[model samples]
Target: MRILLVLFLLAVGCAGRDDGEGVSTQRERDSVVGASNLPGASGVRGALRAADSANARHGRLDSAGP
Candidate 1:
């Protein structure tokens, strides 16, 4: 329960950005980066890749759920 609460708060807290220029800056960056055309993979794939890359140094993240 405590972990769930912490995770909920973490999600909410990360929802807002405090950069000085606001939404327009993000739009400009996205336009330049073509953010809309990203591959249709779920974030788990990215996490798996990251975990694989760090395997040599720190080992992989476990499957235990919070």
Candidate 2:
């Protein structure tokens, strides 16, 4: 949740910039990278990815061979 909040703030801040300059894609990308690098977020993301991989490998229910 906190990581999401930080990302949101970064996006909003960039959007509200004045000086007639439009949105900066670099900053947006940086924000995403920064968010992913946040402490605990990486672990959570890694665990989720691992879970998905494991599920894909063993998702089918079948009877064991005798």
Top-scoring candidate (lDDT): 2
* Model 2: lowest-lDDT 10 consecutive positions: 57-66
Q: Note the residue pairs that clash in candidate 1.
A: none
Off by over 4 Å in 1: 17-66
Question: What is residue 34's positional error in candidate 2, in angstroms?
Answer: 12
Model 2, 1: alpha-carbon shift in Å?
40
For all candidates in order, the CA lDDT equals: 0.60, 0.66
TM per candidate comes to: 0.24, 0.33
Clashes of 1: 0
- Report how far off residue 8 is in candidate 1 (Å): 0.2
